[model samples]
Target chain A: MVAASSTKSISVTLRVWRQSGPKELGQFKDYSAKDLNPNMSFLEMLDVVNDELTARGEEPIAFAHDCREGICGTCSLTINGKPHGPGKGIATCQTYMRSFHDGDIIVVEPFRAAAFPLIKDLVVDRTSFDKIMQAGGFITARAGSAPEANGLPVPKGDADRAMDAAQCIGCGACVAACKNASAMLFVSAKVGHLGLLPQGQAERDRRVLAMVNTMDEEGFGNCTNQYECSAACPKTISHDFIARLNRDYLSASLRSAFRPEAASTGGGGA
Target chain B: MNLVGSFFRSSIGRKILMAVTGVILIGFVIGHLVGNLQIFSHPDHINGYAQFLHQLGPLLWVARIGLIVAVVVHIWAATVLTLENKAARGSNYGFKHTIQATLASRAMRWTGYIVLAFLIYHLAHFTLGAAQSATFKDNLKSYVLTADYRVAGFPVVNAGTKVADVYSMVILGFQSPIVAVFYIIAVGLLSLHLLHGIDSLFQTLGLRSNKWSGCLRKVAIVFCLAYFVGNLAIPGAVLAGKLSPQSAKISAPAQR
Candidate 1:
């Protein structure tokens, strides 16, 4: 096969949101990106932009990304108002320039949330997510010799549900795309994962109760059932996790109310 | 500051705070509803409830302070978080309507602020004794015992003594066309806030998932409606004269 020495590149204008700090006024700065390879990952394209900014003695844009392989869930960018640059099941780093035609105007911005504060440019501190998870998620299983994987025969339905919830990467993309910045999909995923597994059964009541209670304590707006989060989720995690969470929360609350002694005993089992 | 930071910034911290504070607020609402329901139970019951709160001595003071702190933190965290979210978005969209957008989602922030304003007004009118109209002061005087014990510009009295004319104030305030209108608007905004706020809390704390979001939404809607109706009942009863203002006194002996 003959090797090609040179390949044609496409040029596009990028309107990127720029902010000095969380408190500073922010605006979009437009730059014409030239000679970009279609195969370049979205972050790589941004690297080019940073290089140009550096060459021009300007501050480089700030954005968040870790483990570009789509696992860490740290890369958060909303392209043209869609999280992860309009791609389904792909992180921002996995998004390639091939998705856009030449001369297109790409609007790049950070995921928005009150709980998520912008450090600079497209980078935001999403530690609020960690706080939410910390509210209540752990089971009382003590570390011990590895038991057989099949030691616990979880119902097929519970296993499937648990697997579904185990998929969330804590990306905060769902929160970013949501109109109210609701984190239901994210919360539901955690609740569902633990709520289904037999190991999670012990703490199931407390988990749901604590999680839902903590969710309200945070300043995030309530979900209005718009389902924007599920639609916008890159993994396409279904909204069913939220239903399971609700059921768990209700049962936990009811059990605590009508059967406090039984609920306490159940808590001890976990 | 770090405590505040952890409280507002972290998901678990926020969830804890939200749950604890939410439970407190919910408890307050339930208690308030129970006390208000006394208007239906008997005029003396409602007045007795007000007198009981007034008689709390140091306990009343503690409860008031606690409530103030809770309200402040709740409002502060909400405002800060909302502002941060707006900043994160960088620029506001210029009115692109989408099919899936709900009125609750669209007005989430605005409705929250409206509710905040309403809460302040509500506190001022009821708790802080801010005069809404000429009749409110007269009505309050009839029920609430206003002694020389003025703490922080608010009238205070012993718990046993009937403080300001609470029942008449309720009636008179609701009777006023302006005040009645404001209450309606305030409760409406509260309903909207609850509708979205409850669902959002679950999501923020990572308790929601794809499967249960629909059910949660329905529950949120139902609860919001219930709260709205519950709050609206007192004013509705007042306006209809089912609960007469003149007959409503905190220390009034049994009519039977």
Candidate 2:
């Protein structure tokens, strides 16, 4: 292990959250990360620390990561206070040692929220997000084969806006950044992504209603329209999706409440 | 959930409640501010206005009850939602931080509560006349109308009528430095509250979109600043001696 800070290498101290398991008492433990290449990713630096820790016969710090690239939403670390570290449109794995000065003390913790309880050091169970997604069912579409490009013509405005919402990686950075731990941004993104497409129209009403209901049921807070989630999003998802979700939910519930056919057929049973 | 159940139970429902009642309260604030601006006009205009409102009697009570209902619902919705929001957070973060939230947005609950306090004090000071010293309250001036008061070029009332003096009450109320300072501070907080409140109102109601969000933010900023300045002008003018408290006191009728 590179144990010393060389002339060309930078070293820093990591204040890491050490929780052995779910429901375990956790505490921030300081560990000096020595001889780190400045260009190494934050996750790679953690790997180096773990290697050294294992050699010393100490239980290595546990963290979560996958695809080390920015695409996968698996890496969930709140570097310092801001989620995914002090950067915009990048996840924890994408954060590099070069971003910090030498000898900087970096604080690391899991993406903390009631809906996302920590399971181990720097890893939280994000299954609540999966539940929210399940609540919003599959949109009606051809399943067997790839359809023609122009099979369903979509408006340019809607297609573009839908793509914008579709970029959300479900990273929970929005929830981590939110003061109230609101999942409005995350749920709204899925709702907007599916709700905007031509195929999405069939289930749009039920989709928005169910997803938002599940989101609240999972102990997620309501949107305060602060836009902090957007700022923290690795994909920079817009809070406008939350507004769309609000509009869609209200319209859907109202339409269901005042269904003309159901009301008119109420006496037909006689 | 059923429509009524959704309105009372869900987060989105509560948000819509806040927005709808927000619309009503915003209307009241705008109308109250604009009408009070007539304090700079001839005392007859304001006193006549006051007498006209007083003449509404039952209608005025209807409006009051309506405003009271709006305030109650607005507060109730906010309280319930805020508590849920707090509960949702569960454990606090070890490290505190914020990225894009505005100071006003973060302090919304505090500002709303303080504004509620300010509203009660304001009603007591001006509406009930309970805030002022006993003699000061009794000696407030009146206006004996010299000409018929017209609305849209039609006479609403005949000439030679007496009306309660609103102008003197306002001027005297603002003449005290402590009251004036408090008024300015409270209005400032109210404007800060409005900065986020107006923007959030549009967002919560689904009226806002990316296309309009930018323009809406600019409009909110300008409106909040303008509202603060409008509120400032009254107490400021009185404190500056642009209007005379002594002259108002001299014109007051003899206490019965």
Using DockQ as the measure, the top candidate is 2
Q: For model 1, how does the per-residue alpha-carbon lDDT over A58-96 read when each residue is reduced to its tens digit?
A: 999998877888888988888877888767767888888
How many clashing pairs in candidate 2?
0
Task: At residue B16, give the lDDT of candidate 2.
Answer: 92
lDDT of 2 by residue, A1-270 (tens): 112232467899999988998878999899999888877888999999999999999999888888988888999888888998887888988888877878999988888889998888888999999999999846756678778979899999899989998888889999988888899999989999888888889889889888888988999887888998999899988888888888998999899887655556663442
* Residue A47 displacement in candidate 2 (angstroms): 1.1
Please give the RMSD to the true structure for each candidate, in Å: 11.3, 3.9
The number of the candidate with the highest lDDT is 2
* lDDT minimum window of 10 residues, candidate 1 chain B: B90-99
**Over all chains combined, what TM-score does candidate 1 have?**
0.55
**Interface RMS deviation of candidate 2:** 1.0
- Find the candidate with the highest TM-score and give its number: 2
Docking class of 1: incorrect
What are the lDDT figures for the candidates, one per model? 0.70, 0.85
Error of 1 at B21 (Å): 0.9
